[model samples]
Target: MIKMALMALRKLAEVILAAFTFGIVVAIISSAPAEPTDPAIWSFEDTFLFVFVYSPIFFLFIGIPASIFIEGIMKKINLRNCVYTHLVHFILYVSAGSLLGTMVALFFIAEGFEVYIVVWSTIAALCFYVALIGLNKIIQFSKEHDEE
Candidate 1:
């Protein structure tokens, strides 16, 4: 029920991650591109920057606060809750990102618009990072309150 720049950011980050995961999970699992230097590959300009750059960066944005919330949901002094939250966060992220990505992909498919993996990844990474930090900070502050 939260309506703030933070929630909007979380929603956006989740959507982007879901979409990218939808696009790249298939690529990463099936093709197994080893290196950008590998000439035999199908160009990972999109994959690397998107998956590696954006996804991990999202950890800082969505992941940290997500970790805190998961901890709250778990409601225990155990570290397991933290781990569980991270796993759930990642899964949620993929789910949302994939849905958005699929819709976009369909657009690309119909219009024959080339998906610039490089461009998409680059933008997602840049935008999502700011959102991630905001979320984690909220979690951290809340955690302190919980401790007191």
Candidate 2:
């Protein structure tokens, strides 16, 4: 129980860190003009503040559940620690992210769908994956050091 709690805490930390980084990237992207003549959609500070504030909620709702579901599937399949598992996980996350973005864009944003919504969500998923993997590596290293 304690170990599980620790893992959950670690995962939450990873998600928040990933959200922060993802927000930074989104802010940069959203603040730039898509074309030479077009004005940027937002000021950098405004975009950053909005994303940085809201993105953790988005990830907490969507990302944590998806990750837990995926982990359950991996465990059931007896492939949680397999060498090729990360690739499968990556594909699953990217596909899910794309589908989610499409749905959100179609239903919420406006009358027309924006491609950048999909792009940003996909990037956010990738950010979460990278953070998870990095955190896992760090934890493993720390465990090994403690054992030695």
lDDT of 2 by residue, 29-57 (tens): 76755443545456777778888888888
Q: How does candidate 2 fare on TM-score?
A: 0.79
> Which 10 successive residues of model 2 have the least lDDT summed?
32-41
lDDT of 1: 0.51
Candidate 1 per-residue lDDT, tens place, 66-123, comes to: 4446445545534357666656545544444444455556665675544553345334
Residue 91, candidate 2: C-alpha displacement in angstroms: 0.5
TM-score of 1: 0.33
Predicted structure with the largest lDDT when compared to the true one: 2
State how far residue 82 of model 2 sits from its true place (Å): 4.8
What do the candidate models score in CA lDDT, each in turn? Answer: 0.51, 0.82
Cα deviation of 61 in candidate 2 (Å)?
0.7
RMSD in Å for model 1: 10.2
What 10-residue stretch in candidate 1 is worst by lDDT?
121-130
